[model samples]
Target chain A: MKHSASVLALAMGLGWSGMAVAQEMKAEVIHWWTSGGESAAVKVFADQFQKAGGTWVDTAIAGGANARTAAINRTVGGTPPAMMQFNTGKQFDELVENGLLNDVEAVAAEQKWKDKIPPAILAATVRNGKMYAVPVNIHGQNWLFYNTDVLAKVGAQEPKSFDDLFPILDKVKAAGLIPLAFSGQKTWERNLFNAVMLGQGGAKLWLSVYGDKDPAAVKSAEFKNVAETYAKLRNYVDAGAPGRNWNDATALVIQGKAGFQIMGDWAKGEFIAAGKTAGKEYGCVVLSKAGGGYAMGGDVFAFPKTKDANTLKAQAVLEKVLLDPTTQIEFNNKKGSIPVRLDVDTSSMDVCAQKGAKMVADKNQQAPAQELLTPPAVTGAVEDVISSFWNTPGQSVETFQDKFAAALKSI
Target chain B: MLALRPRLASKLSAWLALSPATTILVVVYVGCTAWTVWISMTASRMLPSSTFVGLRQYDALFANERWQISVSNLVVFGVLFMIASLVLGFLLAVAIDQRVRAENVLRSVFLYPFSMSFIVTGLVWQWLLNPTYGIQAVGRGFGFETFRFDWIVRQETVIYCLVIAGVWHAAGLVMAIMLAGLRGIDEDIWKAARVDGLPPWRVYVSIVIPMMGASFATAAVLLATSVVRLYDLSVAMTNGGPGIASEVPAKFVMDHLFERQNIGLATAAATSMLITVAAVVAPWIYIQSRRRRAA
Candidate 1:
């Protein structure tokens, strides 16, 4: 029975993943990619690692935070897995400081990651002038996904900036469709607000607040305008927005009951689930008011230090397969992110993804998500302020601005 | 000495027999509690460390808006839920004791909910409570146009829906316990009541209800623990949402301990809960012991 399952797992390898190789080296990878598409994408890595004579022990927790806590606990308890994922951001900062992670400098050097991977990504993966993690795919945060049928019925064109976004939202309301589908969970609320900030307040405001943590910048009239824009979006959402999952909101757009949703590129999963194709059934662009660029964040796997020789070998194989250009393309194709490598092919990717890849290829257009810029604690604090202002009726825009400035300044 | 096997234990032997249990109690229960209390004082994050930050975590904790909301929501939920459960439970028990036909079937009707886990029931509640596809829309579909049952989505009324679900999940256990107490009553009570020419309701309310002290005590303790350890219902029902209108302490502790990666704050929350529980339960224990002594 075990042999039959192993054979099935081998045949199911997407392209170059392991069945033959995995039999030799066993590596436990703890991650949070448990949804259908996410699991399918992860299987690519597992298969590739297996093909390379390494075993991929998949321990997938459902939620990102749940997985991280488990991984952190295991590492601290001195029974760490071979490789575990962290967002390419400040989440692993404490762990790195605590010396719980092993430097993946060897893999970086082997893959010429410094040359192939984006500087933003490399910078995220590297801390203190040493590589400590492997950068995988880049998920374009802040994409505006819209149902074409709903938009056409309302006789509205795709809005270029958020100014164009509002009138269309009104039209969507008049059409009796959901104006803007929003998931009011804290993380996504913050995501939508940040998208508005980046699109409206522009890259400079984003950098100052997150990258520089300049309180003065957060207190500026520009920041106030961003806060107002973020709050203005509240009126367009349905009453059922609060506590809804991102996918549920995405489902609204997919079902054509909602005209639009401002979400990450990963929202493409919901569209795909409904058998809708991008550019044919739906339209997408980065929902920037200032027309800057897509905000990018993605997954990264860091190897934990281990005494087992087999574990070390498995980590090496997994790293190789993840960064291998073909595997990157195949994985991200199913995963809905651009390949981490800039020089990858664009022919097979959908139009929106191709656009994202092109924008990423251009040096001036790539802006990292706050994950790549700030600590989760700081992001969580800002999220609270954002969600509060968004949810509460009769809330003063000025009060929101002040609190927003305070949160940014403190961070 | 007259038995087939001689009795072996004396005072020294009894001590030997009890050594394992005593050691386990000290090492497992007391030791874990002490460890949690100690960790509450430190500034640990993803992992435990030796940095003593003293009440700083707790200070931050109290200042958190969500935590304050959780405490308030819990107070409202706990009181209303406890009273509603007891009342409904007692009524159901009394109804079942009226010598109705299909008594077992009727009891099962009241008791079946207790057999199911909160996770399954919470989902059913969530689906049934959802505005678009649930009771509200269904009622509207049936041509009752102005129907509005959106308490699940509203900030103010979401807690009541939670109470409704909590009552459904819990009241059954209370009924079963109360029913046992009711059934154990002697026929002499009815005879005495008849001799006095008392009404059926008054006899049951005055004489029979007071006699069921142990049943009420058991039910209160069980429900009180559920009220304090109310993580699953909150999670399965509303997930502390519609902007945290339904947040509770256990969910807060579990979230911080695992998701937030702030073990210090989580432990602090746990220790505070332990203290509160101790304060309430200690006096009850004292009263119970005194009653035992008097008996």
Candidate 2:
């Protein structure tokens, strides 16, 4: 009787294992969006995937460099995750070239992504006439956020150009408030310099400098003015600015202790977390005189190649779910970014996000951020030069221009 | 019969015990180092491939301003951290060896920092040194409104902050080693010095230090290796910043390898560091071996 009972249990276990193998579609995804807002944003995709009969396994790493390193190392070691996240730029070019990633042309064609996605983002995700990654949202990298009460207390109007912005900064300074709440890290310093380049030098100069890698453009008189304007704003920041995190800088503006913070649209997440509504508690403007030449960068998920049928099916499901119109809206709403699809209804988002979505809809106003234009190596080297110039007070503009040109030449 | 074959069996067991470590040393250590040297000569980026561009990466690395700054900062940090830790460790060891009560507690308290990782030490020091919410703020709150201690935010003096944290983390280990050496000294030597009318400080400076050569060498080599691999403390505390003011060689290599996606340049930097360490260490090792053979 004991032997017979054991045999029956073994038979049931074998049958359950067989059924599990045939039906389950599990995907393990590695990403670097682990913050409160970012985690909520990623859960939207996980829920949508689950509702579509797939199991989502989330592996969240905190920093972008760390996550990419782990993902690439795992891919090389032959135990790759089903999906991995990278910046929506040339970061994944090597993965695609090495045949480590699976192309999602089937989903792209089925969803009519070629028409729905913006051409710039589509160009970034596509290489060699194949779609190897899926872009989820667009983040504007050059938005100027201001506290409404502080600006009103100082009787300052929103600056329409860099020329008008400086006097406003001065008034805030004279009113015993920090004129510009700035984070003095290298990346944030580079972000501010890029904003100045676009706002003061225009898109033509930006394309010439970063796109063409033109030595003449770096040495041009107009570029000198851009550098000077960026350097001039260094006077407005407090001494405690060095090594401060971006969110902490945003906090100064939120607490009405500062007038302005030039950061990305992601700053809106901090404001929302602090219960401050956009356009009332604070305001945002993309600093460009040419309507809105918004500087754009974003996140993308690329599927790693796998021969297993179950994993491939799971990848297909994820590719479709990420670009679904409803998923796009829900994900970007939590992420504080505009949806990648131009046709999504963004009216329910904050006023800043709506403005970004409207700007992205117009092709003429879209300027690719520096990461999309140049590789990380070149961008990082130039960032070193810019940060050094900003911190070293006695460094001249000519010396900075020479160093900037030299940095570009090395690449 | 078993007792008669014991020597032969012991010889076989010795070889068996040593084989695994030897194989690992040859394959993992020597093999990876050789592979890195070969890759440094190529123009690899984002991934390693065999497309040779001999010496160009080295030329670029030498010409790069960041690399130059890192080399200079490493020198400043290495010298200061080594001397400061040695002096502090020796003093602590001597103080704790004076037949004090609660000896075990004192030893553990002195050695606690070494048990904690450098990341934790760096973070603790970073908070204590921060201008807004740290020592400076506390000082100002005490009615000293003009007090300032913001070296971590200044370009010129940022590297000293790293030196401070590095010495604090390492001095404990040195103290443990030195204390062991002190306990092993002959008790008759102290009696002899006391009968000869020699002062205790003089005996320590002139006699005891010269006899503790092995312990000093051990502590110096340990501190030297830490200085060469000093990446995490700088990363956690200042991140080579206030604008590349405290950049070190290991951090530069790592940033290029993973973050910048320029593996060729990263490997080239690593190779340069390897050559420098070998240049400094090879002669010392050779001289020590010769002295041992002569003795």
Candidate 3:
């Protein structure tokens, strides 16, 4: 009996050590992609991770702010997830600064992300000479999604620039269709303002106001033009615009009741859900006359600091799976975004995404979005100013400019 | 020493009985409040830090247009909502107290709105108030092409829309409280009033209202609490829009705390709200205690 007991102990010890060598790579990922298309997009990453011999644990909270809060709380409280999603911006800056995030420098270096990813995006992911997040996709935030049927009926050509936009809008309004499908919430209001700033004010003024934080740029005549143009477009929107969701506003365009909507590429998800094809039933353009650039905003996954060896292995594998060229195409295609890596083939994506990819490929036209440029506090303050300006018809452009400058100066 | 031992044992048992409540009050309530106040004075963002920034956050809060609008809007909403809810609820209770038939059914109907959450109430009101596909559209469909009821979409009138929904939601709760108060009135009071040939409204205004002070206080306190924490309603209804016109103090704090990542500002706003409530309630509490002592 004593000899058998000794043999059994030895067998158990060997089994435990053998299991450690082939430990399970289980990654618990927290994200906000709970919608139909968003979930499908996320499943691509899950499937690929599963194929890579890892388990994908999804904790999809419905709202971005809510999911980030849960993930941040868990991380700070020391029981962190293997990975978490953040918008590709300063959302996770403090996490990185406080060393709560593990730098993915190894996988990033292996993939040569610096040579492949756009400069603006690569800069957003890298901090303190190390990459702290793996950027997954690039969403063009300033796209003009218009109804082709409405434009043709109004005898209006698709506008290539802001100069032609007013005429088309006027024609559509005169034809008794809603000229602009607008969502009046503060976020969309700010997005519309950014679209105008990027298209009309050009990239130089865009960088000056947001990136350089130059007060003079906000007070310039060029900015005044952008402000006046944005306000004028407000006249084209119907009274029902306020408090409407972005997808509902997109529905107006889809039904041909409205002419166009200035929204992100994600709006295409709504159109696609309605069985509308891009460039046919609806049209899309990144409107610009000069210095036009795609306003790039997207998602990234950051690995929370964990001492568990299995978790570390999971993070490394998930990072590679997230940015693999094929994974990028599959994920972003369903996500209604372009691949973050510019070298990938975007042939399978629709025309709108293809256009966005081409625009992203040009290094000169790569404009990082407002979130990439400013902290959330500052962006929110500026957004409040923009919403007030948009909704208040009597406010002068000069007064709006001063408020905008003051908002930009806020912390 | 033996006689004192029995009293001492009872005293120890009393302390043991009260320990859990006292601990919860100290740790959860007082402890968190102290932490929040400390966090407010620091330059904290998404995460709390120990670097103190004095009253800089308070200064910023005072300067913020959104916060200023929030405070003023709260005052407006609080005053209107409280008065409207109390008057409407009192009238409803009085109506039902007139020996009306089907009283139970009517009571349930009146109290149904209270059972639904503010989120549901706000959504229902939003749909009913919207201009395009809501009431106005219905009116237009009836060939009233010029019909207009677009208060929810307008900035100036949006807070009033919130008041309307709030009063609708809370009046029912107030009605139930007032009805119980009315039922608690002595039978002899009504009999004496009838014998004295007093009209119902005069009796209600002069005698009954003055006597139901506890009920009025209870309803007002409930409504006041809701007014201070008026977040989900505004979020569900206008989302502080048509351009931050319907913003409230609680929504401002929540936005800064989470979405905007400005914990210092959020906590400062929260602390300011606490101070404001204390300032208002302190005098009331002092007067109440003095009145009770004199009686």
Candidate 4:
């Protein structure tokens, strides 16, 4: 009887080892992609991870700030998820500095990300000579989407410069249509200001103000021009624009009630959802000028530091699956963004995405978005100034410039 | 062996039972408040560090235009919200106390909004106040072509819109409290007023209101706390927009704390709020305790 019991114990041990070998690698991923298209895009990553013998647990929070807050709190509270999302910026710098995030340098080196990823995004994701996050997609934050029918009806040429834009806006207004579809929320207001700053003030001044933190650049004549131009747009927007959501504003353009909207590429998702095709039903312009800069921002996932071997393995699997070439195309296509790796084929994407990809391919025109350039605190402070100036019509451009300079200086 | 006394044993057990609550109050509340105070004096960003920057964050907070606007807006919102809610709620309670038919139904209808959250309240008010599709457009659709009620989108008058929504949400709760207070009052007081030939309005204004001090204090304290933590309403309604027109101090602190990653500035703002509330409440609390002792 003793001999048989020993044999049974050995058999049980063998069975347990076999089970461990085939155990599913489970990972909890936190992200802010809760919209229909965004969820569909995130599902691509989940499916690929599942196929690779990993479990993808999703904890989706709706707002970016809320999701990041939850992820950061979880990390600090020592109940961290396997993977978490952040914008492709310096948002996760504290996590990295505090040794709270796991470095994915192995995957980055294996994939030759240093060579493939765009320089601006590569610089943003890399810190202290190590890759702390994986760049997943590139979103152009300064696209001007206009309704083709409205423009054609008004006999307005596609605007090629700020000088050209005013005439077109005037014509659209004269035609009894809302010239600009605008959301008066703070973030969207900031986005509109950034578009004007980039398109009118040009890349040099944009970099000096946001990147180099040059106070003089903010107070410069060009920046004053940009401020005036942004304020001028107030006349074109309807009185009901304040407190409107970005999608609602986009809906106005889609319904042909408005002529133009300066928004991000994600606005394309709304237009597509409304059964419109890019370049046919609506036209997308990165900036008015041909060589204008495209403000690039996107999302990335960072692995939290974990002592569990299984969770570590899952993180590795997620990092690998997220950047796989096929997964990039599938994910970005649904996400209304271009692949972070410029080598991906653009044939399947819409014309707007194709245009963004082409613009990103030219390294000279790739300007980092404000989040990539400044810390969120500084960006928020400057946003307050810009929005206040934009809403208060009586505020002079000189006062706006001084306040803008002071805001940058506060950082 | 010596036997323990029954009273001593019970007292020891009571102390043991109360220890956990005392510990939590000290650690979670007092300890965290102290930590926040310490952090506010430093130039902490993203995460709290031990770097001392003196009163620099406070200085910056005082200089911020948005912060200034948020404070003034809070004052306007708080005073108006408190007065309006109390008056409306008292009136509601008085009306319902007249032995009305379907008393239960009337009470619940008056108290329904208190059951809903501030987020729901804000969203409902947002829709109702929207210019393009809400009341204004509805009025225009009904042939009132010149009807205009777009205050929610305007900067100067947005706080009043918030006040309207705030009063609407809170008056129900106040009504319930006032009604409970009125129900608890002695029947003898009403009989005495009638014997003295006092008019109903005079009795209410001069006697009932003055006698319901405890209920008024209760409702006022509840309303005051909500005023300090007026975040979700502003977030769901205006998002501190139409260009920072409807921003409140709590929203500013929250934005700086998490989204902007400026913990020092956020704590500075939070500490300032705490100090202001204490300054306002400390003397009143002292006077209340003294009055109770005298009584």
Best by DockQ: 3
Q: After superposing candidate 2, which stretches have Cα over 4 Å from the reference?
A: A1-23, A290-292, B1-12, B99-105
Worst lDDT run of 10 residues, candidate 2 chain A, spans A14-23
Please state the Cα-based DockQ of model 3 relative to the true two-chain complex.
0.81
lDDT of each: 0.84, 0.91, 0.94, 0.91
Which whole-number lDDT from 0 to 100 does residue A167 have in model 2?
Answer: 92
Give residue B103's lDDT in candidate 2 (0 to 100).
93
Question: What tens-digit string does per-residue lDDT give for candidate 4 at B1-295?
Answer: 1455877888999999999999999999999999999999998898898999899999999999999999999999999999999999999999998989999998998899988999999999999998988899999999999998999988889999999999999998899999998898889999999999999999889988888999999999999999999999999988998899999999999999989998999999999999999999999999989999999
Candidate 2: pairs in clash? none
- Candidate 3 fnat reads 0.85
Q: Give the alpha carbon lDDT tens digit for every residue of A300-375 in model 3.
A: 9999998878889889999999999999999998999999998898899999988888899987789999999999
Candidate 4 whole-model C-alpha lDDT, 0 to 1: 0.91
List the candidates ranked by TM-score, beginning with the highest: 3, 2, 4, 1
Model 2 has a DockQ score of 0.64
Backbone Cα, N, C clashes tallied per candidate: 12, 0, 0, 0
For residues A1-411, could you state the per-residue lDDT of candidate 2 as single tens digits?
998999989988975784477368988999999999999999999999999999898999999999999999999777789999999888888888889999999989988999998888888899899999999999999999999998888888888788888899999999999999998888999999999998888788888899899989999998998999998998899878888889999999999888999999999999999999999999998777645378889999999988878889999999999999999999999999999998888889889999899889988778888988888888889988998899898899999999999998775
- TM-score pick, better of 1 and 3: 3
CAPRI quality of model 1: acceptable
lDDT of 2 by residue, B1-295 (tens): 8776988899899989999999899899899899999999998888898999999999999999999999999999999999999999999999998989999999898899999898999899888888988899999999999999999889999999999999889998999999999998999999999999999999899999999999998999999999999999988887778888888999999999998998999999999999999999899999989999999
DockQ of 4: 0.74
Q: Sort candidate 3 into its docking category.
A: high
TM-score of each: 0.92, 0.93, 0.96, 0.93
